[model samples]
Target chain A: MRSVATNSTARPDAIDERILEELRMEPRATSKALGLKLSMTEVAVASRIRAMEAKGILRVVAQLEFRAAGYNILALIDVMVADRKINEVAEALSRIDRVGSVTMMLGDPPIIVQVQAADSADLHDLIVNHIAMIPGVEQVETNLIIDIAKWRTGSAQLHPTSLPG
Target chain B: MLVDDVDLAIVKELQKNGRSSNREVARVLGVSEGTIRQRLKKLEAAKAMRLGLVTDATALGQTAAAYVRIKARPRHARAIAAKIADFPSCSFVGLTVGRFDIVAFISATSRDELVRVVDAEIAVMEGVLQLDVREPVGYAKHRFDLIHIP
Candidate 1:
């Protein structure tokens, strides 16, 4: 999604706000249903959605039930790489099916990758065979996620939203 | 709940366009509108599907993002994770097994705002003993879930 102006300045009209809220609550909602809820025609809701998406206000992402896909093991790996090769290493990490997301940082250990594996052996294989083979990687530290208690996303829920509110 | 190919197909279509109408989905996938609606209802009932917003925080003006590696006092890791989760800026928080007991992903709009979260919110948490804050420049590959598995 394209970054919008701050939520305040980028505030949509009352109707768009309602659309966003509705989409947020039900990502699978049809424009017809949304139109009915807003007392508008399906065509109206569909056009508004297209406009919002063009502005980077909303993005539709496929949410796979990863656990069911047998990707149960989750780990956060802090990677130290040759300063110049961070981009290459990050791109390689992204291609791996077991890797969830890679975060490239500013300092010493420049790469932080969130990985999901099937088990301990799978993680070891990723580190030794896949990630290590990627050029420029210096060191790898894997922090196994023992438990996940809670989670949330979207700019509206994070701290920045809190401060401005 | 087992998701058949049709169910996966519906999820795939909606994943690409959440607001896609059942009629449209049926037309593209060559299924009847009734079948599409039935599969969607079953998937939703099974709690295997949900709607959400996914974004790259940095792209949204959240330039400061760091992995806060933390050590908690024995059983206090759970409490500390809950604290990190409650912080408005913290996007993802979880307990880990390694050098650190807990690892969290937090982000803020600016360096100053990020520090405030670390200093005031994370540092002062009851169980946090020590932490290493590493600000990542960007996320080369960022996605919350995988729907179209090849």
Candidate 2:
């Protein structure tokens, strides 16, 4: 699996940022269409996109809304583990199908993960039967996401402008 | 939002390659281009899914990231969450239940930016009673493409 911290010194130029902005708004827009909108030739636009992809900076993918996809319960699970086995437990958690994202954090609860389940029962099983059973997992805290006020994906990275005060 | 096997297959296919043309998907799935097009239209109309570009912020220099759990004053959690969500650094803002009333995920260009947003901005908000920031030492997995379909 690819690490989240995949490094690259390459950066997008002004033109590339404009292309990304356009793609953010219309992901499926063809190169020819984007060329027309951005006043660039189709080959130029397509080549720039290809360069970004080659550099591992951008990926166009089908983003699924978990709640809408029928996995109603979304919870953040923080796990306290035996210090020596923290990495082992995190790796195990990452392999689980229900676990969405796993990050090893600093301090008391060394691991945190976003998990989804079809219902409360499944979530219970995941925590009790699956996660809790993992070796070195001393404790678990779950925070259920009740409502999401904002979930901007890739858009915010380019436009770091804050909302009006 | 009644998704069938075909819908799931289409989504699964696109999850692997979002830019796959309708004809390519049709060829792979042994279906007509029209069927692939119609299913995609239906899935999108229901807001079940969408094709989009996911940028690697780490590659783009936003290396610092963290999850902030907050305890807020009663009845103000949702409002505070909405405000927090508006911050450009915050990628996710959700009202949660358990130890904290709100949870937010933020990524910034540097550690200093992360500290500024969490300390100077979020902590000083009126309704924020308590806040705990957890910075990732390392990420074992961060999969946005995969989800439990069941």
Top lDDT prediction, candidate number: 2
lDDT per residue as tens, model 1, B1-150: 556788877877876766677899899999899998888777666656654665435335666777888988978999889777877687778898899998888878898998888898889988789988888776666655442221
* Residue range B71-137, candidate 2, lDDT tens digits: 9997888888989888978878899999999999989899999999999999998889999988888
Model 1 pairs whose backbones collide: A105-B136, A158-B88, A159-B88, A159-B89
Q: Could you tell me the TM-score of candidate 2?
A: 0.88
Q: List candidate 2 segments past 4 Å from native.
A: A1-7, A155-165, B146-150
Off-target runs (Cα >4 Å) in candidate 1 are A1-18, A30-45, A152-165, B55-60, B146-150
Question: For every model shown, what is its TM-score relative to the native structure?
Answer: 0.81, 0.88
- TM-score, B chain, candidate 2? 0.90
What is the Å distance of residue B128 in model 1 from its true position?
1.0
Q: Give the CA lDDT, 0 to 100, for residue A152 in model 1.
A: 48
Write the residue-wise lDDT of candidate 1 on A93-114 in tens digits: 8787677677778786788998
For candidate 2 chain A, the 10 contiguous residues with the lowest summed lDDT are: A156-165
Highest DockQ, which number? 2
